[model samples]
Target: MVQRFDLAIVGGSFAGLACARSAALRGLKVVVLDAKPDPGARVRTTGIIVKEASDEFDLPAGLMRKVRGVRLYAPDDRALDLSAPGYFFQATDMPGLMHWMADEAARAGATLVYGKKFESGLEYERGVALGDIHAGFLIGADGARSRVAEAFGLGVNRRFLAGLEIECEPLAAVDGRFLHCFADSKLAPGYIAWMVPGVNATQIGLAASRPQRPDLGGLLRRLKAHFDIRDIRVTSRRSGLIPSGGVVHCLGARRVMLVGDAAGMVSPVTGGGIHTALHFGRRAAMLVADHLGDRGIHPVVAMTREAPRYRAKLLLRRLMDLGPPNALINAALMTAPMRRLAQRLYFHSRGEKSESFEAWCKAFEQEPDAKPHLKLLT
Candidate 1:
C-alpha cells in the first residue's frame, strides 16, 4: 500500500527535520526519510551554532556550550583574540542535538523514517512517488552530493573543501573560553584548523581545498605548541565534503525543491551551512505549504528570489583556495587592518570595540559559575 503525504523530505538532519516540523505543525502531512539508522548516527558538521542561529532558534541549553571568543593563530604561533560583546558561538553535542530535533519534529506530527535510503523517485504532474510513498511536494535536504539534484538535472556543487574532524575527551590544558583556530598554509592549505571545546568533548578538525588534504596529525602537532596533548584520547572521527560554491542555479522544479547543502545553501568562505539550512529549511516549508495548499506563488520562483547569492564570499573562497604563504600571513596577521577585518568577519557589527582577551578572561574567572544565556528573538 502506498502511503501519501503533503510533503516529503529526504535526509533527517537539520534541514530536513526543520522543514518537516514546520510543515507538519502547519497542518500538512509530512514524511522524512534518511539512510542513517537513527537521527544521531554518523553526524558530519561540527555543529557550531552562531549567534544569529541561537537567537532565531530555541535550542536546548543543556546540549550546548557557549564560546564567547575566538583565538586565531598565525603560522608562527602569534595569536589574536576576537569577540563581540553580545555575540557568542555555541558548540553542540551534535548527535544529541540531532536526536532532539528529530524528537521535536515527531512531536509536531512529522513521520520520520530512518534507515530508508532514497534510491529514485518519479515526479508526476500531481506528486512525486518514492517507493511506496507518494508526496504532493518533494524536498531534497540531502548533503553536498545530492542524488536528488542529479536525478532532477539541477545544478550541482562544483567546488568543495574536504573536511576531517576528531572528537576526544576535553583537554584540560586548553582554555575552554575561546574557539582556537590555526591558519597554516602547509597544514590546512585552503582552510583552517580548529579546536572547539564542545559540550562534553574537544573537537579538533580541519578542512582544505580539492588537491590538498586535511592533516589531523599536523594539526595535533601544532596544538602541542600551545597546549599539552600527550594524554589525549580520541573518541570519534568524522569527515565529509563541504560545498564552497554558491547556491545552485536551479533550486527546484514543479513540485520538487532542494534545501540545505543540496541547494548549496552554504557559505563559501566559512563553509558554514547549518544556519542557512535551518533558516531556509523552515522558509521552504512555508513556501511549499502556501504554494501547494493556498494557490500561492510557485515555490521554485519564490525560493530562487529568496536564496542567498554569496557573491562576496564566493570571491573570498576563490582567493582562499590559492592558499596564502605562511610568511605573508605571519607578517600581515597582527596589523591593525587585519585585526579589524578579522573582527568584522567573526563578530560582524555586534560591538564597536571589543574588550581585551586578558580582561575578558579575568572577568570570566571572577564569575566562575556564570554561563552564557541564549538571546532568543521572536
Candidate 2:
C-alpha cells in the first residue's frame, strides 16, 4: 500500500522541521523524509537567532545562550563593538534543537521518517517507493546541495565561501561572551575568520573565497599570532560552505516550495541563515497550507513583498566584491554620528535584518565615492 500525506517535506534540518511543525499546527498530514540517521551532525550553521524571531518559532529557551553584542576585528587589530539589543541567542547543542523540533512536529500530527531520501520528478507529486509514501505538495528544506532542487531543474547558482573550522580551548582573549570576527590578508582574501565563544570552548574558523591553494594553516597561524593565542588545545573540527546567491525562481513548480538554504536565503554579508531559515520555513508552511485550500503560492503577497529586499542586499554584496571599496566601508563604520545611527537602525532591523545587509546596501549607495566606508561595510 502506498502511504500518503497532505504535505511531504524533503530534508529534516532546521527549516524542514520548522515547516513540519508549522504545517502540522495548521492541520496538514505532514511527512518529512530525511536520508540521514543523525541529521544534526551535518549542520554547517553557527546557529544564532534574534530574540524577537525566536518567539516566532517557539524555540526551546534552555538550548540557547544570550549574547548581547558582536565585536569585529580588522586586519590591523582595530576593533569595533556593535550592540545587538533585544537579540540574544547562541545555540550550544544544535542537533538537540533539531530533534526537539522533529518531536514537536510529530506530536502535532506529523510523521517524521529518518533514513529515507527524496527523489524529485514531475510525475511524483507525492513520490512513493518501497511503500514509504507520497504527498500533494513537496517542500524542500535541504541544504545547498539539494537533490530536490536539482531534480526539479531549479539549478544552483554562483560560488560561495568555503570554510574550515576547528573547536579549540578558549583563546586567551575569548571571555565566553563575545563573538569576534577577523578580516584581512592573513586569514581570508574576501571572506572572514570568526571566533565564536561557546559555553566551554570556542569555534575558531575561517571562511574564504577559495578554500584551496593558499596556506590555510598559515592563515590559522596568522590568526594565532594576531590574537596572541598560545597553547590552545584542539577539540573538534569541520568544514562547510556558505551560500551567497540570493533567492532563485523555480523553487516552486506546481505544488513545490523551497525553504532555507535550498532556496539560497543566506545573508550576503555574514552568511548567517538560521533566522532566515525559520522565517522562510514559517512562510513556506503557510504557503503550503494555502495550497491545501486549493490556492497557489505565487498569489501570496509575502513572497513578492520580500523579493526586493533580497535583491538590494545581493546588489550591495556584488559591489562590495569590487576592490577599493573597503576603505569607504571602514570610514562609514568608524564615523561617530553614523555609528550611533547604525546601532539604532540595527536594533530595528532584527529578524529579517539581523545581518544589516539591505541597510548596508543603502549606506553604500548614498556615498558611492567613499572608500573608507566600503571597508566597514565589507
Candidate 3:
C-alpha cells in the first residue's frame, strides 16, 4: 500500500514548511497545500527574519542580507539610532526563501500540492475530508485570514491591522542595510511605517490597527512622501492583515492544530511573525509527533502552557497604545534610565526578561519576535 502522509498542512508558508520539514524528518509522511502556484508571486509580510531565527534555523544564506542597524524616528522628528554591537537582522528574499524552504520540505519527504486552496469547515465533519486524503493530523498555518481557523471552529484573529507595503527602487542616499522606521498618528496610528533594504528594491510599509478599515493606500502614499521616494517605480505591492491578539484561543482540538499567524503568534506591537512562525511551526510538529508516539503530556494541555508568555506580550501591547504616541516614544526611548538599561539588551537573552520593554522591542526587531516584560506588568 502507498504510504499515507501522517499530516496534511494547509498553506505552504514559512511556518507550514517548517512543520512539514520537522514532521517528515521524524519519519512521518506529509503533504503541504497552497493556493498560489508560485510561492513568491505575491508577497505579504516583510521577511525581516531576526538573527535569532537565522541562528535557530538553517535558512538559505544566499537569499539573505544582514542589516547593520536601525533608524527610528519619533513623531516629533527626534531620531534615535540603535546599533547593538555584533547584533544584526536579516532581510530575506521572500519568494526565493519560501520556494527554497518548500523544496527542502519536499526533500525531507513532504508532498507539496500547488494551487490547492483549502476551505474552512473541516471540523464540521471533524476533518473527515482530510482524513480521506490519508492524513491523520492537520496543521493550520495559512495566515491571519486563515480558512483553517474557521474550518477547525477555533475562531480567528480579532485584533489585527491592515498592512500595506511597496517594493521599490532604492531610496536616495539611504543606508541600504539599515532598517528605517517612522512613527506618526496620521500615517500609522497604533503602529509604524518602515523601509527595509532588499536585493533589487526596498520594502516600505505601514500597519494600522486604530480602525477596522484604515485607508492603507493613503498611508502608503504619505509614507512615500515622508521619505521623498514618491517618484520611485513600484516593483511589487503587498497587502495583508497582521494579527496582534497574542495566541489564539484554540491551538489543538481532537486531531487538528493551528500554528503561525493562524495561532495569532505574531508580535502585537511590531506586527512581525516570521520568527515566531518558524518557532511554533517546528514546535507544533514536535507536539504532534510526541502525541502520536505517546511519549509526552497531552498535546492540548501542553500547547496551552505557552499562553502566559504570549498573554504578557498582549497586555504590554495594549499598554503601549494607551498613551500619546510621541510621549511614549520619548519617555521610553529618550530617557536616562532606559539609556543605561539598553546596554544589557544585546548581552542578555529572552530567558532573562528583566530589561525595559522599549529596549527589548528594539532588540526584538533584530532578534526573534517577543518583547521582554516585567513579571509584575500584567
Candidate 4:
C-alpha cells in the first residue's frame, strides 16, 4: 500500500520542522522524513542568531540566552565594541531547539518519520512520488549537500566554508555576556573567528573559505594569546560546512521546493540562517498551501521576490573575500564612522524612501572614501 500526504518534508531540522508545522496548521496532511532517528543527534551550527530572529519567530524562550553586545577584534588587537541599548545577540541550545521543533511539528498534526531516508523520487501528472509515499507537494529542507536538490536537478551549493568550533569552560576574565569576533586574514581568510557566550560555556570557532589554506588550529592559540584564556578547559569540539554563494541556483520546480541551507538561504555577512530559514519556511509552506488551493502563487514568483537580498549579500561577501581580512576588518569596522556605517547596514540602511536592496547597497557606495573599495555598485 502506498502512503500519501498533502505535503511531504525532507530533513527534520529547523526549516523542515517549521515548514511541516506551518503546512499542518494550514490543514494539510503533512509528513516529515529524516534520516536521523533522533532530531537532536549530530548537531551542527553555532546557533547564534540576531535579535530580529527572536522577535520574528516564536521560539522557545527557555532555550535562548541573550547577550549584550558584539566585540570585533582586528589583527592589530584593536577592538571595536558595538551595541544598542535594547538589541541582543541570542545564543540557542540548537539540538534541543530542533528536538522541540520536531515535537511541536508533531503536535501541529505533522506525521514525522525518523530513521528513514528519502530515496529518489518520481513525478507524476498530479504529484511527485517518493518511494511508496505520494506527496501532493515536496519540500526539501535538507542541508547544503541536499540530496533532494540533486534528485530534482536543483543545483548544489557552489561554495562552502569549513568551520571548526570548540566549547570550553567559561573563562573568568572574558565577559560571559559578550560575543567576540576576530578577523585575521592569515588565520582565516575569506571568513572570521568568533567566541560566543552560551548559557553554560563559550563557543570558539573559525570559518575559512574553501580555496584558501587556513591555519585553523593556530587560530585558537592566537585567540588565547590575544584574550588571556590559557586556563579554559575544553568540553567538546565540532566541525562542519557553511554554505556559501548565498541563494541556490534553483529553489523550486513544479511541486518541489527547497528551504534553508538546501536553498542556500544563509547570510553571507554572518553565516546565520535561522532567521532566514524560519521566514522562508513559513512563506514557502504558505505558497504550497495556496497552490494546493488552486491559487496561482508560483514558486518562481517566490524565488524572484527573495533573490535580490541574497544577491546583495553575496556581493558583499565577495567584496570581503577580495583582500586580507586584516585590511577589510580594520578598515571597515575599526573606526567610529565605519562602525556607524556597519550599524546602518545591520539595522536598516534600506533607504529612507524605499526599503529596496539597491538603496541598501547605496549605503556602501555613497560612503565617503568608498570609491577605492566599494566601486562595484557604481
Q: Quick one: best TM-score, which candidate?
A: 1
Candidate 1, residues 250-299, lDDT tens digits: the string is: 99889899999999999998889999999999999999999888999998
TM-score for predicted model 3 compared with the true structure:
0.82
Shift of residue 270 alpha carbon in model 4, Å? 1.7
Model 3: residues with Cα > 4 Å off, grouped in runs: 1-3, 120-128, 210-230, 322-333, 337-378
> What is the TM-score (0 to 1) of candidate 1?
0.95
Candidate 3 local distance difference test against the native = 0.73
Model 4, 323-353: lDDT tens digits are 4547666666666577665555444442223
lDDT tens readout by residue for model 3, 7-102: 889989888999999999987778888888876666787888887899899998789877755666776667655555445678888899988998
Which candidate would rank higher by lDDT, 2 or 3? 3
> Model 1 — which ten-residue stretch has the worst lDDT?
369-378
Question: Cα lDDT for residue 123, model 4?
Answer: 67
| TM-score head-to-head 1 vs 3, winner | 1
Q: CA shift at 68, candidate 4, in angstroms?
A: 2.1
Q: Write the per-residue lDDT of candidate 2 for residues 1-378, one digit (tens) a residue.
A: 778788888888878888888899998888888988865656565565666567666777677665555666655566766654235546455667777877888888888889887765453544322245667777778777777788767646465767777777767676444567665544565566677776456677777654332235865776667667777788777777777777665565665667788877877655677787888787788877886765654512455356324666677556534422345445565566645644553354453333443444455567768545444332
For residue 20, give model 1's deviation from the true position in Å.
0.3
Candidate ranking (lDDT, best to worst)? 1, 4, 3, 2
* Residue pairs of candidate 4 with colliding backbone atoms: none
Shift of residue 171 alpha carbon in model 1, Å: 0.5
lDDT of 2 at 257: 63
Among all windows of ten consecutive residues in candidate 2, which has the lowest summed lDDT?
Answer: 123-132
Pick the winner on TM-score between candidates 3 and 4. 4
